[model samples]
Target: MTKKIVVLGVSGSGKSLIGKNIAEKLGYRFFDGDDFHSTANVEKMSQGIPLTDDDRKDWLAALNKLLIDNPTAVIACSGLKPEYRAMLRQGLDDVAMVYLKGSIDTIWERHQKRDDHYFKGRGMLESQFATLIEPTEEEAFVIDIAQDADAVLNQALSLLSES
Candidate 1:
């Protein structure tokens, strides 16, 4: 079955790059979850501020709409909370989430080197990690962020194939 894979992680975890590669290899469409975030939300993050759950309500709803629209597109998102993931899963049975596990230090280093994004400099890392509800045993497959892009994508693809 062609399923929509939602890659979940905090910033600098390589969700976009790895997600696109996984989609390409799996013959699915790739949708960056950031694309679904509202401009004001992005602006808030750009200024090194954390967004409230109220801020994310529409964003999660948008993810649900995305799944409803595309049906089988692979998406990358910082689904940091169980409620957020539940929101995205509304009415979508075929959606599978891949939690990219990694350390804050590692991600902070990557964030320092990262360019062209509003989220950076360890500003939102604590909030994200604090909010993250790692997929339970019955929830989703958890893939560690390995060496590079391809390694991560390979692990995700393998998990998706198994699922």
Candidate 2:
């Protein structure tokens, strides 16, 4: 059976990058949640400001809808809050979350090295990580990201295939 997998974490957690690989390995399409953000939201992030829950409501609703649309695929997003993950999973019973967890040092280093993006800046990532609530053991797969991409994708694909 096909699976709807969500790669989740704070900014710089490599969710999008690894989600793409995981999707490819699983032969599922990949959707980047950043693309679903509104222009205003993008502008706010470009300014290095965090989005309010109100600012995220519409975007989360859209993502939830898209999860419904693609019953079997992989998507990536900073699902920082438990509520946000729940929102994305709403109305999509087959959807599961995979958290790419890592240390502040690793994430901060990656964020600093990340180039050509509007979400670049220092310190704001602290808030993202602070806001993150890791998924429960049963919510989905949990894997540390120090492993190579191939290994991570192999494990993710295995889990997706089993589900």
Candidate 3:
């Protein structure tokens, strides 16, 4: 079994929910990467600001350390860029990535129903999509999220088993 897993997607793509489910099913610790963000980052996002690479440098390092500290855990993170994913994987060879894939319209609809999140607005979502560098098949299990969340979770679990 892969001991370390990161659920990757833009906001509103269900990374947190799916990551939690994966951790529960695997009997592993769950960490929401959002909780590890700096106060400044959170503040910026609350104001509808898109974070740059430099803004994420320290955040990624902290998440990498979290992975190092907890050998068996699942994390929810945006990981929009390849370099960001690389940073998250630093010093971790057994890490697995599960990307929740969905169309903007689909995710936007879902985002509308969500509540109390720092990240908001269609523009923010668009910025996230613009920043996204999707992982290759070899790099992550890509689960289509146009289906129901339950189906998406089932598919992710099934893929993990196969891999």
Candidate 4:
């Protein structure tokens, strides 16, 4: 079966990095969910404005299409809420989610160092965490992000193998 893997977490949690690595290791295509965002949504986030569910509907739909287009792919996305995840899983039968779990402080530190991303500063990170509805262990392979990137990737690979 084709495996569609979503690397999910709050901003600065290493979703893009780890997801890309996972895709390389698995020989699958990699996609950043941020690239699926509409121009309006990007503009709002660029201005440090948090997006409402309505603002996210189109972006989520686009991500879902990406999944459909690349069945065996690794996608980096902030699948922060259950409903958001459900939207991504609309028609997929073999989807696996890897939640890059991390403490707020750790993620905040990383966020502070990032200069190129639109997800700006501690406030945006706080908003992301606030909106997050963490997935249960049964629902995802949760890998802690405190470790080095390679270590975290290894853990994710190990968990995916088991599943």
| Candidate 4 residue lDDT tens string, 30-104 | 999999888898889999999999999988888888888885888999999999999998888788999999999
Candidate 2 differs from the real structure by a C-alpha RMSD in angstroms, to one decimal, of 1.4
Q: What is candidate 2's CA lDDT for residue 51?
A: 86
User: How far out, in Å, is residue 133 in model 3?
Assistant: 1.0
**By lDDT: ranked, best first:** 3, 4, 1, 2
Instruction: For each candidate, give its TM-score against the true structure.
Output: 0.94, 0.93, 0.97, 0.96
Model 1 TM-score, 2 decimals = 0.94
In candidate 2, position 34 carries an lDDT of 92
Against the reference, the lDDT scores of all candidates come to 0.83, 0.82, 0.92, 0.90
- The CA lDDT at 138 in model 1 is 73
Model 3 regions more than 4 Å off: none
Identify the runs in model 2 with alpha carbons over 4 angstroms from their true place. none
Instruction: Choose the strongest candidate by TM-score.
Output: 3
lDDT of 3 at 59: 96
TM-score of 2: 0.93
Clashing pairs in 4: none
Best by lDDT: 3
Candidate 1: residue pairs that collide? none
